[model samples]
Target: MSRIDYSVWDHIEVSDDEDATHPNVNTASLFRWRHQARVERTEAFRKKGAELEEALAESKHELTRAHEKAGELAAGSSKARDDIERLKREEREWEEKVAAHRREEKKTPWNADTLCRGGFSKIAVINDVKTESVGEETETFMSFEKRYEKDVKRFAAMRSWDDSEEYLSDNPHLLCAETFNLLMMMCVDLEVLKKRESLEQTAHQAVVMRFISRLAKALKVDPRACFRRFFSKMKAADQRQLDTFADELECFKEEVRSAAKSPAWKAMDEAQRELEKEEERLEVFESLPEEMQRCFDRKDVRMLQEVIGRMEPAEARAHMKRCVKAGFWVPGAKVDGGDDDGGSDKEEDDA
Candidate 1:
């Protein structure tokens, strides 16, 4: 069996591992001082490395620009050739400096703080809604409705991005998957209502949420934690970026309209209209005069005739009209003083 070599471990600088010190010396203070000095040294080395890396990047950029300029100029142009050669030399020098920096970094002995770097990959909830873990129930539209439906509606109604950013900044807890789902549903509802302006505004907000969600995914962070970053980027975005965003907003609006035109949405709209009609009919029925209501309830032609006879002509006409609209009275039905051969009694009050 081969013996493991421990020579690599000799360079680890454990500050507090000193086995001996003067009796009067403050050992704790000494250890702390050593740790602080080591940290300062490491930070200085890292800063130097960063500066070298930046220089190298700048040099490479200049070299690339020079090469492009050289290509554009005449083949025999002396100025472009001179610039390219100078930039190439500078780039090589910067690269050498960067290489030296890396070698120096490797030479720096590892300390207790740097021996083994620790890394963490975790998603933390920023608000009251905790992130669901494996085996936990994920947030859904129904659950979102139960919690944030009203808040989401208020957010959707906001016409300005500035106001929306402020709102989300204040209520970071709402920057979740559920809130996104609600916003999308709101867009669909607004589209179904034929609210073009509101639909566009809500669709824009939904698309913003989607972009934030995507950005968070790309950065491997919680959407709630990084939503403000998205807003900041948007606020500073160039015209091209803004135009792309606008395009996405239009596409999202189209999607909402498409959803609203689906068979399921058509059926829902029809059902909603029927319910509204029924409610209106009930309201008209309730508002009718007691005599007319009784006549309809009893299905008595004579009673209706007597009631209409007692009432003023205009009042009787109004009541009968409401009853007809409410489905209490059928059009063309025979009544007292009217022809019995399937004729309407609508003109009976004239007599």
Candidate 2:
């Protein structure tokens, strides 16, 4: 009636019950499904290929960066190696220079003998001069007694009588035997005079006169002449004290003589010889070369010796001008032109 769409069902197949014993399946339909499956597989393969391509590009970039970093590290390593080599060379050079300096130092000898030519004690001559100034007044006898007491106490404290025996055995002057003997004799005479009342005045005068005579003799003067001169200076009250002082003076003179002959004298002589030798050696060494001579111009004696040992004599002589300028040595050891005889030869040739 209204043109129902029965024509739309034209391709639709209806199978009768009697004829549907086996259902028909088309090969084309199977081929169409297989084609779709194949298309899906191809699309998946394309996606995987695209992903692999992107990953490969990123890997290539990373590899390029790694190579750049490796090159930079290699360059730094090379620079470090170069610096190490340079430092090693500098170290080697420094060591060589130090060794050379040490070798130079070894050639020279240290001479300390120069300092000892004279005894270390300074000797000065003191002239007696009159002074208006007066010191605090003290009795001469009291002062002498105090000094003698102090000397005795010091000697006792030192136990010099016992401990100094070894030194005395080696050197008789160290014991001051002559002074001790003089002191003992004077003491015995005084004791005897004190006990004899009847002969006291005569014995006192005789003892005093004899003591004064002995002192003058020890001093290398005439006893009678010296006593007359000495008595002229004294007031009557001081005469007795002066006589006593004369006795002490005699003993003191002997002590001084004995001390002078001690073993200290021998040691001093040895020291003087050593000093002379040192001065001689240094003077000879200084005469060597001009440059070496210049080194001696300085006050550093040890360094001059070292430099001298290393230098040639001719070279050192050439540098003598510097030594002359510095005043370490006198100049003109080397002459200009030739020897003194050469002048005469030159004059004969000119004539």
Q: Which regions in candidate 1 have their CA more than 4 angstroms from the true location?
A: 1-140, 238-240, 272-351
RMSD of each: 11.8, 54.3
- Each candidate: how many clashes? 0, 8
Candidate 2 C-alpha error for residue 266, in Å: 2.8
What TM-score would each prediction reach against the true structure?
Answer: 0.48, 0.17
CA lDDT of each candidate?
0.74, 0.43
Model 2 over residues 294-337: C-alpha lDDT tens digits? 55455444455466446555554444444444444442232344
Q: Quote the RMSD, in angstroms, for model 2.
A: 54.3
Evaluated against the true structure, the overall lDDT of model 1 is 0.74
Lowest summed-lDDT stretch of 10 residues in model 2? 107-116
